[model samples]
Target: MSASTSAPANSAPVAHNALPPPSTSSAARSSRIAPHSHIKGLGLSPEGFANLDTAGFIGQNNAREACGVVVDLVKSRKFSGRALLLAGAPGTGKTALALAISHELGAKVPFCPMVGSEVYSTEVKKTEVLAEVFRRAIGLRIKETKEVYEGEVTELTPSESENPLSGYGKTVSHVIVGLKTVKGTKQLRLDPSIYEAILKEKIVVGDVIYVEANTGAVKRVGRSDAYASSYDLESETYVPLPKGDVHKRKELVQDVTLGDLDAANARPQGGQDIMSVMGSLVKSGRTEVTDKLRREVNKVVKSYVDQGVAEVVPGVVFIDEVHMLDIECFTYLNALLESPMAPTVIFATNRGNALVRGTTDVISPHGIPVDLLDRCLIVKTDSYTREQVSKVVQLRANVEGLKFGDGVLDKLAGEGEKSSLRYALQLLTPASILASLAGRTQIDIDDISEMNELFLDAKTSASMISESGAAFGS
Candidate 1:
C-alpha cells in the first residue's frame, strides 16, 4: 500500500449520492459475491444475513456510514501510513467502531491514554530510549539463508590504542595470542597450543572469538582464516570474534522520578491507575496501566503478532473523558501517534466546545500542534431514541443469558428517557442473577416488576421525591 497523503483541511464529508437501483439479475449476482466487503469476522453469509435483531436498533446508520468511510480508506490504501482520529461524546461507541476496523486490518493496536502524572514524569532521555527500543522491537531481524564464505586475515588491527606495551612486536603478540580456527580453514595462523586450547574450549566454526596480544591489547582474529593457502603450514584458522554484549531491555524502565516509579509500581499489579482504568472502561472495555503491565501483556500477545489475536488489532486506542488527561500525557500521546505503528485514538468527552476551547494551548501543552487536531475527524454522538433503548434492553438480556418474555422488554424500555443502554445492561445483570437464584427459567413481566422495585428501593426516598418534583416542575 502507498503512504497516505494529507487530506484536505476543510473537505466536506463524502456524500453517498443516489444511484440507479440494481437490476434483478445484478442484485442476485451481487448477493452471491459477499456480505459487507469491509466488515470482517461478522460471520454474515454472502446474502448479508445478520443474526443481530435490528427491530429496536436505531440511529446507528451514521455510525455505520463512518465505519464505511474508514473501511474505504483502508481498502483504497488511503490510511496505509497515516494516523487518524475519532472524537465523540461519552458512550458513543467510537471505540467499538475503531475496533471493528482494526479487526478487518489485522494490525497491532496500542491503547495509550493520557493521564495527569504521566506527562511530567516521562523524561527526554527516557523518550529516546523508548524510541530505540520500539524500533528494535518492531524491526527485529528475521533469520534467512545466505551463502557462507571463507577468507584469510592478512593482518590484525586493534580499533583502539591504549598501549600497555606500545611496540609493534608487543601488539603482535597480544593480537595473535589466542587465535584459533577450525582445522584446514584458511585464516589467521594460530600456535599449536592455542589451537588445542580452542578445541578444548569447544569453539565452533561459526563462533567468533577475541584474541589478546602480548602488548595487553585486544584484536579480533577470525579462525576460518587459518585454512587459507596464504597461512603458514603451522598456522591454524582463527575463530570469528563476538560482538560486545549488552544488557537485555528492562520492561518497566521509565524516565521518571524514583518516587513516581514506586507509586506506579505500587498500584494493584493487575490493572492501571484509577483514572486510566476508568478511561479504559469508558473507551474500549480494556484496561492496562504502567509499562511493566504493558510488557507482560505484550509478552503474551507477541505470539499472535501475525495471527488472529485481537490484541494486535491496529488503530484501537480509546480514551474516555479526554478532558481529564494531563498535559504530559497528551504530549506523550502526540509523539506516540506519530509513530508508524501507533494505534488509532478515540477521544471522548462531554463538555463539548469547552474542552477544546483553547486549541493552541491544549495542543502546545501536549507537544502536539494545532495541525494535529485538524487531521482528526470529529463525530458527534446523539442521544439514543426510545426504539434504540428497547433494542439495547433485548441485546443486553440476550448477552446476560436471560430469557425475557416479549412485552417485558417493552416495559423496561419505557421506564424513563434517562435510562441508557449501559443502565439497561446494569439492570439486566442483577435481574439475571436474581432469576437464577429464584430457579426461574425465564425473566417474565413479574421479574421486571421485581427488578424495578429493587432499583427504586436502592435510591433514597428523598431523591426519588426530588426527581418526581423536578419532573412535575418541568
Candidate 2:
C-alpha cells in the first residue's frame, strides 16, 4: 500500500478543497442592511432646534406666557385629556401660539382649521368625515384582540331501572365527552399594550384587521372610525358563537396601515385639492343647506374625538367674517366648544350685532356664549404705531439682506398711515429686486427711492424725492 501511494507518476495531484469567494451581488445586499444607519440619532436636528425671538412684537410677552401655560399642560399630560382655546383678532398670533405648542410637543402633525361650508354641509355627513379627518390628522392607529370558542357534544344516558320496568332487566348507559370548537366573541380593552403595538407597527386609521377569538373562526373588523372608538369595536360588529361553547381565544390576526393625509399630501396637489373642496363650499352664495352643513361639521368633529387625537391636540378653528355664519351655524359653534373633543374656536367680525341679540348688547357684536367666552383667551390686535411701523420696515429690510442708508427706513415707514407689517414686507420685496437688477448687492437709499416713486408718486412725489435725497446725502 505504501509503494502504491507513491507510484501514480502520471496522475495529477489531488486539488485542495476550499469554499468559493462571496459574490459581488451578495456583498452588495449585505451592505444595504443599514439603509438608515446614517440617519440614526438625527432627532431635532440643529436647524430644527433654532430659536427665533418674538420680542419685537408688542404683545409677545403675553403670547409667550400663554404658550408656557399650554406647554406646562402638555408636559403634565393635562392637555392629553382636555382642550384649550385662544381667541384673538387676525395677525394677533393665535395661530403662532398653536404652532408653538405643536413645536414644543415635537409633533409633526399640523394644526388644521375647521372651516368651509363643506365642513358643515349635510351632503358630506360632516361628523364621520371630520372623525376620519382627525384620525388622519393625528395618525392614530388601533388594534384589538378577539376570542373564539369551539363546540362540544354530550350524549344522554338511559337509566337501567326504567329499562328493567319495560324489558325484564335490560341495562343501558350513556357516555358524554366534551369537545372544544371554535366560536365565541371576546371583548378587548383599549390599553397601552394595543397602543404600543400600533405604534410599533406604524399602523394608522382606515386600516382593516381580522378579529379572532380563543377557539373560534376569526372575524374581520374595519377601522371605519377614529382610534378613540376602538373601545367600542365589539358592539359595532357581529360574530358567530356556538350554542354551548363559551371559551374564547384572542390574537392579532392582521393589520393594514391607513392611507391618511400624510400619505395623501406626499403627492402633488393634495392640500390644494382639500382646500379647493372646502373653499368652494364657503364661497357658495346659497344658504340652503346651512343646517345640514352644520350637522355634518359636528359629526366630523365627533369622529376626531373618537380617535383620541382631538382630545390630545385640539385645533383652533378661526372663522373669518364670523358674523356671516347663520344663526344655526353660530348655535352649533356654541355647542361645539362644549364638546369634550371639539376644537377651541375664535370668531372675527367687524359687525358686533351679528352675535348679539338685543339693544343692550353693546359689546362688540361677535358675542360668543358667556361660558364659551369665559374659556377663551382673547387679545385685541391694534393698528401699528408710527414708531412700530418704522421698526418693522427696518427689521424687514435687514431680513432681506438689504443695507439701507441712514433715514431710508424712516422714509419707507412714513409712506402712509396704513403702512403695515405686510405692506412693509411687500415693499422690501420689490426694492430688493430692483437693487439686484441695478447690480447692487444690498438695498440702499436708491432702491427705496425707486420704490417710493412706484408706490406713492401720485400722493407726494416732492416730499418722497426730498426724503430720498436726504437719505442718500446726494
Candidate 3:
C-alpha cells in the first residue's frame, strides 16, 4: 500500500534559479583547483648599480643628477610616485639611466624590468596584465614560520647493490641518516647524491648537519662538541666546532610578490590532489582573487608591519622602449600611476615624432600622450665627449674581461666618438678575438685599426645602398 501527502496550500513552488548549497560530501572531495605562477627573483642587483655609478659611466652628468633626484624622492617615503621618461638618441645612455635608477632604489624596493610590448597577452585582458604588473611591483613582507630540522648527524647508512649494473632494476636505492640533538635522535631518508656530498665533505659520526629547505642540499656544519674536545690542541686531525641543529623550527623574513601570494591563495583548502580528481577545469592565469582574499592578505601584511616583523617596500617597473606600447596600453597608464598601489614607473624611448602603435595619429617626442608625458619627469641624455667615450670604452673593456695593450683603448674610444658608442663597443669583441688568433695576449693599436676598417666598410655599404635608392627614386 502507498500513501501520498499533499503539499501545503500556502507554500510557493521552488524557483528554478535557486540552487541547493554545496554538499558536505562535495566539499570533502578533492578539488580541481588551478596552479598559480609566482614572480620571484625579479629585482636589480646592487653590483649593476655600482657599475653605472662608476666614473666609467662617463658623461651624462645631467641625466645622473635626475636619477639621483628620483632615488631620493622614492626613499623619502613621502613622495607618492611618478613616472620618469628618459629621452635620448640610441646609445646615448637612456637604458643606462633607467638601470641606475633601479640600482639606487636598493634591496628594500623591488625593481621589475619589462619591455613595453610585454604588457599584452592573448590569455588575459590588457587591464588584467597591467593589474598583475602593478601587483608584482607591490610586495608582501611575509614573516613565515616553518618547521625545519637543525641537529648533528650521528650515523649514516647507504643502501647499495653489489652489482655494478642493474639493467632491469635500480641500484643505490636510498641513504638513511641518523641526526641527533639535545632533545632526541631522528632518522631521515636522503637521496644518494646527498649522501655522496656528506662523504665528500668528510662528515662522519657526531658531525653536525642541516638540510636547506629551498634546495635539498645536505650541508655538513661541524663536528659534535664531545668529539671535538677529545682531540688535543693543534692536533693534525682538525676537529671542527660543534654545529647547530639540522632540524628545528625557523622564523624567516622574506619578500614575496603579490602575484606569488595570489597564486598560493588559489590552492584548495582541502588539498591539491582533490583538484586533480576534479579534472583540468582550471587553467593557468584564470584564478580570480575574491575581495575576501584581498582583505585577508591585507590583514596579514598590516599585522606584520605593525608588529615590526615586516615593512612595506615600494617597487620599480622600468619599461624600456616605451614607445613600442600601443595607445591602449598608454591610456591604461594614466589611471595605473594614480592608483594608491601604483609603482614608480620609469620609461625610456629614443623616438621623436613617431606614430603610436595601432593608430594613424603621430605623436611628438615619444609616442605617448601629452598628459602622460606631462606627468613624467623627463631626463634628456646627450652624446658623449671624445674623452668621455674613451672612458666608457675602457670601462666596457674591463667589464667584458678583455685585456688591451697600451694606447689601444684611447684609439678605440676616439673611433667610437666618430661612429657611435654602440659601434665602438661592438668592435672590442672581434678585435680581442683577432688579437688572440694572431698570437697576441692583449689587443693593440693594430687590432683597433683593423676593426675600424671593418666598421667603416659596413657603414660605406649602407651609404651606397641609400644613394642607389635615392638615384632610383629620381
Best by TM-score: 3
Q: Could you report the Cα RMSD, in angstroms, for every candidate shown? A: 22.3, 22.9, 23.6
Give the candidate number with the greatest lDDT.
3
Which has the higher lDDT value, candidate number 1 or candidate number 2? 1
lDDT winner between candidates 1 and 3 = 3
Off by over 4 Å in 2: 1-59, 74-94, 114-321, 343-364, 367-371, 382-391, 394-400, 415-418, 456-474
Model 2 lDDT per residue over 291-366, tens place: 3443554465458557643433444344444444444444455555455545333444434334443324434335
Kindly indicate the candidate among 2 and 3 with the higher TM-score: 3
* Residue 155 C-alpha lDDT in model 1: 40
- Model 2: lDDT of residue 102: 50
TM-score of each: 0.44, 0.43, 0.66
TM-score of 1: 0.44
Q: Which is better, 1 or 2, measured by TM-score?
A: 1
Better of 1 and 3 by TM-score: 3
* Superposition error at 36 for model 2 (Å): 32
